[model samples]
Target: MSRVLVVDDEAGLRRALAINLSARGWDVTAAPDGATALEAAASTHPDVVLLDLGLPDLDGLDVIAGLRGWTDVPIIVLTARTSSADTVDALDAGADDYVTKPFAMDVLLARLRAAVRRGAAGEGGAPEVVEAGALRVDLARRTVTRHGEPVKLTPTEWHLLQVLVTRAGRLVTQTELLKEVWGPAYGRETNYLRVYVAQLRRKLEEAPAQPRHLITEPGMGYRFEL
Candidate 1:
């Protein structure tokens, strides 16, 4: 059974998630606050995390950062905050996906399954190393280096880069990238692509204004050229 950590301040939602997930053969661990969620994550080593941003003890971003410090466990933010800035912050902080409040259980479950699959896939069977210009992506180690120096990429950023680099010299459509990197629930959220791609270019490209490897193919998608 796949383990899931459900972190929410609302007791009712926590219970509901635990019961529903448990019914579906998931080993569910519940936490009512960020501190407990972090502790549970460390102890249980869940395959995916469902986190709420409005924690009474700590911000959900902090929890994400804490988990990213030591683990690559997929984090899905569950929050009432629907602002783009909040979404970007959570993703940049290391969340694998984000779901706003008032979500359909089915959609959430699908996303959860997708995250688990992605996590498993990331564990093996990818190119060990990909080089583009001065950037070196070590897929085996999940690390990126540019100009012989470590380049720190958020989990989301790294995932995006991985998708592009693995398909190097190919055009990956916005819909495909969204579904592959985020979840099936995503497609029209091209703004998310714009934001994250810009962030990646800033870190990986020689000039953010004129990116070399990460190229945007106007109105279609992005291509990573060698």
Candidate 2:
């Protein structure tokens, strides 16, 4: 069974989630604060973590950065704070996904599945490097190359790539992309998306004006074909 760590101060919510997740066949673990959650994560090594932004002991962003310092274990932030800035902080800090409070269990399950798939794919990468025409991406090491030379990406750019690659070929909603890549604060900042898209095209696309992999869906969102 896949292991899952749930961190929330609300006793009822924590217990309910533990029971529900257990019913779904996950080995569930619970913590009431950030410090305990971190300990549980490091010691138990869960496949996915359900983190809450409002902790009794520490800032949620700190928890994300703290875990990132030691592991790539996927983190999904669960919070009542719907602000885009809150979402951006968590994502940029190293969270894999964000889910607002009063969320549906089915949607949460889907996010868990996505996180698990990405984590598994990260471990089972091909031995040799992969190329997008002249641009080469090292699947195993999470590095990129252009014309056989390494190409540097900003931290935000890398996170965006992670989201795109995880949902490749599917049209990820603009709000979802922004939440995944930038956080909740940027979910409505379509301008940020436009700027980042241009930046990514300039670096990854052969022609910045016409992109093949990074595609826009008009009023919808973006998708990475590869």
Candidate 3:
């Protein structure tokens, strides 16, 4: 049985999730606030975490960051925050998936399973290193270096770069990138692509205004050239 930690400020929702997940044979632990959530995660060592952004004690993004400092366990955000910025923020903080409020239980379960699968894949079977210009990306270590210096990237930014670098010189459509890096629910969120692409350019390119490696094909997609 897979262990899951459900973190939400709403007492009733926490109880409901616990009952439903228990019925499905998952070992469930629920927390009413971010601090408790973090504590439970450390003690229980769950396979996955269902986190709410609107916690009473601490924001969920911080919780995600905290967990990421120690673990890569899949984290799925469950919140009513529907704005693209919120979604991007959670992804950048290290959430593996996002589910809006009033989501279907079946859909959440499917996403949970997908998150687990991706987590497993992340552990094995990916190119070990990719080089583009002065930037060198170590996929297994999840680190980037430029001219022998470390280049810091948020979780979302790293995921975006990973997709493009793995498909170097190939046109990765905006829709495909949004779905693969963010989630299927974000296929239409082109603004996210724009923002993250700009961020990546500023970090990885010789000039942010005229990017060399991360190229945007007008109205279509992006391509990475090495």
Tell me which of candidates 1 and 3 scores higher on lDDT: 1
Each candidate: RMSD: 11.6, 7.9, 11.4
Native-vs-model 1 lDDT? 0.86
Residue runs of model 1 more than 4 Å from their true location after superposition = 125-226
Point out the higher-scoring one by lDDT: 1 or 2: 1
| Cα lDDT, model 3, residue 220 | 55
Looking at model 3, report the run of 10 residues with the lowest lDDT sum: 166-175
Kindly provide the TM-score of model 3 when superposed on the true structure, using C-alpha atoms: 0.60
Top candidate by TM-score: 2
Q: Write the per-residue lDDT of candidate 3 for residues 1-226, one digit (tens) a residue.
A: 8889999999999999999989998899999999899999999998899999998889888999999999999888898975656766676567766778999999888877766665666677556898877899998899999998999999999999999877565456777799899998888899999999999999988889998899986655787877
Which candidate number maximizes lDDT?
Answer: 1
lDDT of 2 by residue, 95-189 (tens): 77777889999999888877776677667763345455787766567888877777789888877876776555445667888877877776688
Ten residues in sequence with the least summed lDDT for candidate 1: 166-175
TM-score of each: 0.61, 0.64, 0.60
**Model 2 spans with C-alpha error above 4 angstroms:** 126-163, 166-226
Question: Which ranges of candidate 3 are over 4 A from the true structure?
Answer: 125-226
